[model samples]
Structure formats: structure tokens, C-alpha cells
Target: MAFDSLGRFGVWRSYTGFTPEEAREYEQLGYGTLWLGGSPPADLPVVESLLAATETITVATSIVNIWAAPAKEVAESFHRIEAGFPGRFLLGVGAGHPEHTGEYRKPYDALVEYLDELDAAGVPTQRRAVAALGPRVLKLAAERSAGALPYYVPSAHTAQARATIGPNALLATENKVVLTDDTSEAHSIADGTVGFYLGLTNYVSNLRRFGFTDADLSMPPSDRLFDAVVAHGTPEQVVARLTEHLDAGADHVGLQVLGDDYLAALRTLAPLLAARS
Candidate 1:
């Protein structure tokens, strides 16, 4: 299936904040996919808008929250996009954190039920993915959807997820990056975004699972954890760190550039990443 591919690298960003022009520019820069974050709504007009703007690049929802976006409605949106844009849309869904969702309960079971609904609604399994973190969900993602999209994860977690999902399932890992040579500045910039995820229990637990202690998960996130989670340094240094996911078994690395000028950062790293390829 065409939806099964995301090349070597892609861009991950908040879907609502993204513009059609930026999507076009991303496509021009040679990113194979745009993994939209921030839990898009069921209608997915932005997905369609970006698809309309570009001819080839894939637009995948990093996740549509399973609780917020009903399966039937999301399926309809999937069908609509598939009809118009063919294989350009990949539906990524997840059971959001308990900290944020009031209705979140028995997340694994809810995810299974959501997948069932998507199946009944005729959404192809190969065209969807799950925002999986642990082994259980990673296995579920492989079995029920195309594969797993592990968010805010380190390379160690990526390696674990790939093993859990086995050799064939897609492993599109989201990696945060701050392109700068100042290590201290990078940590400061990353803390703004990474700090929020640290507050979420699921993320914290995963960090713990991979050996991050209470100190590492601290408010500012210990420098070691920051370095492990967010790639920072000069473009070359950041790219080297981001590629760690690929080495660890990620099939595609979604670069979530953290900075004021995302496009400028992307533009700077694009050639470097391409040269590596």
C-alpha cells in the first residue's frame, strides 16, 4: 500500500498552525510526509487543503484523538481524502493521555473499540496508524493499523518499538530538534515544549521504562534526558542525533523542529539530511 511509506524523513508539526503554502514548501524541500500533530478534528479539512496544495507529499495526522474524533466521522474524512487525493492521506489515531482527556479510561480497550469502528466503517487497516508508546500498544498498532507513530520518544524507545512491532510494520518516530550550537540555549528552547510532555504520566512512565530517573524527568528535564529526547546543536550535529532513530530501527524520522522560524530551520537542515541520504 502506498500509505505504508514515509521515506527516510518527514515533518511533524501542529496541524492547525500549518499553512498550505508551508505544506507546499515542505514538499518542495523533499520531505516524504507531513505528520500533523495537535489532535486534528474529524472533518480533516486541513489535510485536504494541504493535499490540494501539493501533488506528491503525504499528509498524516500524527494523531486524531480517539476520544475527541469519533471513528465514524474520521472514517468519512478518510474516504473523502482517499477519493480525491488517492493514497496521500494516512489516518493516525491515538488514545490521548489521561491527564488531558476527561473521558479517558481503559485506553487500550478504547483503542481496540475505536479500531473496530474504523474497520466497520471501511477504513483500510493499511492506511491508518496508532500513536503507540508501550509494547502492548506497539503490538496493537502493528496488528490493527499500518504501524506505530511513537511521539516525543528517544532513540532507545524507538529501538524498542521497532522490535515490538517486528521487522515489517512502519516505525515512524517523532523526534524533536533544536538546531543550534549552544547546548545551554538548546536545552532552554526544548524545555518550553518538552517540559509539557514530561508532565504527562504516560510520557513520564515511558521515560522511566527507558531508564530516565526522577531527576531526568524534573521540570527542566535533566540535560541528559533533554539531549536524548531533543536533537540539538549545529545542523550537522542535530542531524547526526536525529539519525540515531534510523540507526535504532525507525523506518522514518519525523523532524519536529522546535524554534520560532520552523521553515528556516527546516531549510537549513534539509540539504544536510539529503546529503546524508
Candidate 2:
């Protein structure tokens, strides 16, 4: 919705890893929002735990797959969570990858239909957003929903999206961060994670649209590819990179730690972001 106080820094965690208590700890750690990833099914109980744990932080779905969680079911969950914890939930829904779902066909049409269903069910357009990347979907997101929650995109793309969606529409982007100074090792970890997304057509296409070529998108992503996608360095360096997104017109940037020790990473970066705030 109007993510007015969600802050610029947020945590991107999987629901399976973070318990409600852990979520509360993150809120205390100064992260303004908790973005649950991994296409969780429509279950308000899980959302409720997150809302109950934090007093003011917002809980959002990085995305609930439109294929798996139907609009009606999502709307029902939305109402339940809203009734229990008003103004604390933001629904981020997406048409998941075609390779992952049998129902993945004409995702644009599917998203439109889902939005129509959400509308008819009384879920306000301002309370939700779509996980959009391309121009068409991005434009549709501005028209039909609150704004766009674009994942795995860079600051350059954010600049373009900001121009396209105008200044008022929300532009929230996710950046993978590794708070390590070791360039080689950091890139290795980034490659392992980047490899999966590089293989996804939607991500690859978006990267190409941003000027990376087929050679750049080749297997075992080139150093250029890795650098463009992952922002790895010291905390200051990471903050510098993330600031580019905000400068490029992002309303908020969700920082996803690449390493296993997520809480430590959050603790490390919070102060730097706080200083800027």
C-alpha cells in the first residue's frame, strides 16, 4: 500500500527459516519490513504470527504465486490479516516462472485476471503490488496495483522504472548483498546464487534489456555479470551500491544477505543505513 514508514532497508527471508520470534528480533534490529520469499501458500496464520511479533514493522510477501495461491484465497487471507493487524500487511503477488508451474501461460493475462478477482473481492488496489519486471507488467502494475516489487534488478533498471512509472508510484527493488571483503570468495558465493537466476528466462531477458549481451549471460556468469547482479564488498561498499538504487528512484530497497548468517549481516548493515537515515 502506502509503504510510508517501511523504511529503505528491509529483510528478505524465507518463511521456513524465520520464526515469528526471529521476525520480532529483526524488527528490533531496525529493519522496517520483513519480505517473506519462496512463494508461500495463502495462509493468514503465518502472516498473523509476523504481525503479532512486531509492533510497527510491515510484513510483506516478496510474492505469493498466482498459480499456487488463487486470488480468492489470497483475498480471504488479506481480509483475515487486515482484520487482525490493520495496515501491517502488503500483498505482493506474481505470476511465477513458467518452468515451475503447470498453470504458467500468458502470465500477463493471468495477472490481470487475478487483479480483477482481487478487486471484486474488495482488496483495495493500494494495499497490494505485483512482482513485475518487464515494461508491460510494470506499466500494468502502476495502473492496477499500488506499484511494482521488482526482484533481482539493478539500479539502472530502477532508474528506468522510475521514469516509466513516474515519481509517485512505488519502486521497491531487491539487492543481494554479501558483507565480505574477499572479492574472489564473495563472487563464488554470488555465482552459486546468481547461476539459478541467470538460468531463468525472465531474469536473463531483463538483464539483456539492461545491455548485458548473450556472452555476458553465458554459463558461469562472467565477472561483469556477477558484479552487475550482486553487490558484494565491505558494508560501506554495499551501502554505496544500494544507495545507487535509491538515487535511481527506488522508494525502498530490500537487502538480501547472500551468506548463511543472515542475522549477523543485518546487524552489520543496519547502523550504516541508520546513519544515512
Candidate 3:
């Protein structure tokens, strides 16, 4: 509920990517929150583990897919963690891609139902956020939950999202960044990273809404699209790209470092980001 606890920036990683020790070190690095992506299981022991390992840093699920993680069960886990860790955990939920979820139909409706179930199960709306992309869901998130957590998007979309959600709701945008100066290497890594999301229809549809052309959405996305979505180059350059989202009305920006050595990138950026704060 205390959104300010999740400072201006956070780190986004796969649910299984961090060990308890690594989480503690990340906390030490001064980022305010650790967002676990990859739609973690209903009983979130990993979240608990990280919460236990760190003292004050917030731990949030980038999202727990509604189709895969049942509302009632996740609510139980929320209570368990809330009881032990108190105000250090935030629940982020979403309807996953249709390609993966066989039961993914009428996503907006299903998401409303899931939120209703969570409401009945005693999960406070202020403590949760919805993964929203389009206008309808963005409005729903602002009205029904704490805010929206939009993934795989640019500052242009962030600006649009801010207008839709209004000024008060938390707009935590996930940005995929490669901390390298080589243009070729950055796109090479981005191709492998951003390319997968391009396959998902929802993401493509969302991009179209933001004026991305068919050519930009092709198998190998246009350079314009790549440059717009993923931030690369020196830490200063990446920070500038992230700052654009902040200027566009993002309350929080979670960096999903794209490369094999994630901690190294985080280490490299930590001091610079802390200085900005």
C-alpha cells in the first residue's frame, strides 16, 4: 500500500534468478524493490525467501499469472507473507498470453473475476497491481487496484498509459536494457530478448495501438522499434532512456537487464542510479 517504499527504480528478474544472498546484496545496492517476473507459483516461497533475506527493500511479483496462479491460493500466500514480513510485499497479477494459457479467453473479464476473488479472500486493493497494456485494462487497474504494471513497452506508451490511468496510480514500467556501448551487440542481445515478446499477439496489438507499423512488427523488428523499446549503451545512456519514462509519468521503472551476467550489470548501474536519486 505504501507505494513510495518502491523508490524510483527497481530490478526485474526471473522468479528463480536470484538466490537469498543475491537479493540481500541487491538490497545493499540501494534499489528500493526487487520484482520477480515469470509468473511465479501460487504459493510464493521465493518471495518469502527474498523478504526474509532482506531487511527493508520491497519485494513484488512482476506478476502472478491469473490463469496459472489461483486467486484464493495466492491470497493465502499473501496473508502468510504479510503476517511475517508485514508491508514489504506487493502482489502483481495478470492474464498470461493466449499462446501459453489454454484457458485464456475474455482476459478482461477473467481478470475482473480474479480480482473479485482476491477481494473476497481479503487481499486489499491497495496492496496489489494489475498488469495492463491497453486502455480498458489500464482504466480497470486504476479504478480496481493500486495501479498498472505494463511490460515490454516504450516511453511513448508510458505517456499514453499515464493519461489513461490518470496521475495518482502507480505506473511501474518494466524496461529491458543492455548495458553495453556496442550497437551491434545491443541489438543482438535485444533481438533475442525483445524478439520473443513480439511473437505474442497481445504485445503486437498493443504496439499497433501506439502507432507501430506492420514493418516494425515483422519477424525481425525494425531498428526504430528496437531502439524505441530496449535501452542500451553506456549506463548514462540507459539511465537517460529510463529518465524519459519518468518524465512521461512513470512512478517506478524496473530494469530487466538483458544479458547472461545480470548482477554485473546491476552493480555497474547501482552507483549511478543511486546518484540520480
lDDT tens digits, residue span 102-188, model 2: 767999999999999999999998889899899999999989988999998878899999888877888888999888989898877
Alpha carbon lDDT of each predicted model: 0.89, 0.86, 0.91
Per-candidate total of colliding backbone pairs: 1, 0, 0
Model 3 TM-score, 2 decimals: 0.98
TM-score-based ranking = 3, 1, 2
Clashing pairs in 2: none
- Model 3 scores worst on lDDT over the 10 consecutive residues at 186-195
* TM-score on alpha carbons, each prediction: 0.98, 0.97, 0.98
Order of models, best lDDT first: 3, 1, 2
- Which residue ranges in model 2 land beyond 4 Å of their true spot? none
Which scores higher on TM-score, 1 or 2?
Answer: 1
lDDT of 3 by residue, 1-277 (tens): 7778998889999999978998899889988899999989999869888988999999999899999998999999999999999999999999989999987799999999999999999999999999999999999999999999999998999999999999999999999889899989888777977788888999999999888998998868788888888888899998888888989999999999988877899998888888776
Per-residue CA lDDT of model 1 for 192-264, tens digit only, reads: 7989988899999998998899999988788888888889888889899988998999888999998887789
